[model samples]
Target: MDVGDLLGGNAWSYVGGTLLVLWALVWLYRDGLQVDAVADKYVLVTGCDSGFGNLLCKNLDVRGFHVLAACLTEKGADDLRMAAGPRLKTVLLDVSSRDSVQKALEWTTKEVGEAGLWGVVNNAGRSLPMGPSEWMKVEDFHSTLDVNMNGVIAVTMSFLPLIKKARGRIVNVASVLGRVAANGGGYCISKFAVEAFSDCLRRDIHYFGINVSIIEPGFFKTAVTSLEPLEKELQRLWEQLSPEVQASYGDKYLDKYIKVQRLIMNAICDTDISKVTGCMEHALTAAHPRARYSPGWDAKLLWIPLSYMPSCVVDMGLKLVLPRPSKSV
Candidate 1:
């Protein structure tokens, strides 16, 4: 047979084979192991004031788990209490503070009693002053790291004994930024640290039957990704820069950056955050949970693939899309 005939005839075969493989993988993934006595399980979720933490607490409560929803403020706790059922309890927790984490641990220990904790969801995070690296102060990076990275470690370490006793799950809320360094700031660095920490923890505790799952979600309409707040923060950071620095990145650059940010948020951010919380739910309840879950179409299709691409290729693509600084080198 000629080259053209052979190529045309085999194309269909290749496509069919790929589809069959994907179907089989999906089937296996969906057919998770059985979970027993879900009602008896106790789960702790941080940052329950809003977003995925709040929704997950409600969902797990409805599913009959004893949910301990940790909020950063009294108002948040009260609001969560009103929304969740009677069985879902709320605690005041600030993961960045050791004293707060200790108090939360004491409360959670008392609440769970001998049954122990079935899961701990580290979902508390912050993203601020997320402009170019040149505009950031050391303190800005430290502040984000304290809340996002250190907080996760403190909370996890505090709850390890309880989780180990139940041989349960640890669901760390990372980001697609963890895999891809698309943004400049502590948000991406903190997430990258979380991914590494989860991997190491998983391997270390696997022998004890403790499962570690990392959730890498793309842009979602949560308080963390709120456009108004982010824009204000960017402006504040820009204002703090020295006059020389400000002149280097002119007012026009800042304006263009804000416009681009608004456009991206409006165009790409997923309003339905349930896609992320669903992954968290499955990780906690499934008998055999996955090590990692990348929710949202953007995460699964775009960011994840881009993360694996060559650095030069990724950088070129980023340059095309990202706004150029006024005095870019």
Candidate 2:
């Protein structure tokens, strides 16, 4: 066939048009369908003190779902209660602490009762003491892992029975960093653990009619991404380093490290957090929720794609973007 004939809409055009139509239909069917009886369902969201968790709690309350908002502080709980509808209940939870998670679980059990918990959104996490892995101490790693990784595991285990009873959804908040490992410190490591845990949990629990979904959002403006606390934390790490170690890295390395982070965060951080919470909501309410959701343009266009690239390419790109250590050969 002549090229002009194909351009003029021949069998090739028909095939292309048909494929586009089929893609659209599949997209609509996947996103448009939602589960019924949301009013009777209960969804428990952690880290409701602020950010995506807070917004999701408000949105879910407005949608008529019984939203159990878990805040780490009394002020956060009070603030959430004031903003959300009366159907929204608040629980004080510190997911990193075993005792706190247990108490919250008991409270959640009583609140949910026989209907059980319809959804568990593990939105709590920490992202600090982030720099060169060598600059960090074991405690620094644990401090972030305690909240971001162990916290997710503890919360999921505590609520697994309840979720099984309801045969409902488990939505765990990971990050695009989980797939890409584009940063140092425990933040990416913890998220990588979340990705693995979510996958294993999904396979193990699917037989019980439960669905586990992972939310891998790119950077957003939240407490997790705040620069103030990070500045203080990184400074402390630098100061505590032994004299030889400090000399090896040079006095100005810390400045460059923080500056690089600031530049990246400023360039990529999305202020519209609803982009993430909307994916979480869909994971909760969709009749056939996706196993994973990457909820930002950066995640779709950059980080996730980088994760699939050849290791040598990713390493070379990182070497160009990331600062070299003063002690490097």
TM-score of each: 0.92, 0.94
Candidate 1 clash pair list: none
Query: Tens digit of lDDT per residue, candidate 2, span 294-314?
Result: 998899999999999999999
Name the runs in model 2 displaced over 4 angstroms: 1-20
The candidate maximizing TM-score is 2
Index of the highest-lDDT prediction: 2
**Which pairs in model 2 have colliding backbones?**
none
How many residue pairs clash in all the candidates, one count each?
A: 0, 0
Candidate 1 lDDT over 1-329, as tens digits, reads: 89999998899899999999999998787757658899999999999999999999999999999999999999999998998799999999999999999999999999999988999999999998698888899999999999999999999999999999898999999999999887788999999999999999999999999999999999999999898899998888888899999888776988888888888888879999999999999899887899999999899899999999999999998888778767879
In candidate 2, where is summed lDDT lowest over 10 consecutive residues?
Answer: 4-13
